[model samples]
Target: MKDTVVEVKSLDQEWARLILEAKKIGLTKEEIRAFLVSTKEL
Candidate 1:
C-alpha cells in the first residue's frame, strides 16, 4: 500500500468552545457525534 499523509486543521474556535461547554455539562464525544448525525435528517 502506498503511504499517505493527511493534515488536519484545528477545529473552529466556536466549535471548540461549544465542545468545551458540552463537556463541562457532561456530554461525551460519542454523544456529541451522535447528536450531530441525528441532525443530518433535518
Candidate 2:
C-alpha cells in the first residue's frame, strides 16, 4: 500500500472531523497516535 501525506496549517474543522470519527468508533487517543505512527513507518 502507498502512503499519502497530508499537510494542514491548523487543526480546525478537518482535524475535528477526524477526531470525531475516531471517537464515534471508540478509538482512544493512544490508539489513534499509535496508528498514525505505524502508518508513517509503513
Best by TM-score: 1
- Assess each prediction's global lDDT (C-alpha) against the native: 0.77, 0.80
> Residue 39 of model 2: what lDDT?
66
lDDT of 1 by residue, 1-42 (tens): 998765444445666777789889999999988876886789
Tell me the deviation in Å of residue 9 in model 2.
Answer: 6.8
Q: Which regions of candidate 1 fall more than 4 Å away from where they truly are?
A: 1-11, 39-42
TM-score of each: 0.54, 0.51
Which residue ranges in model 2 land beyond 4 Å of their true spot?
A: 1-16
Go through the candidates in order and give the clash count of each. Answer: 0, 0
- Which pairs of residues collide in model 1? none
Clashing pairs in 2: none
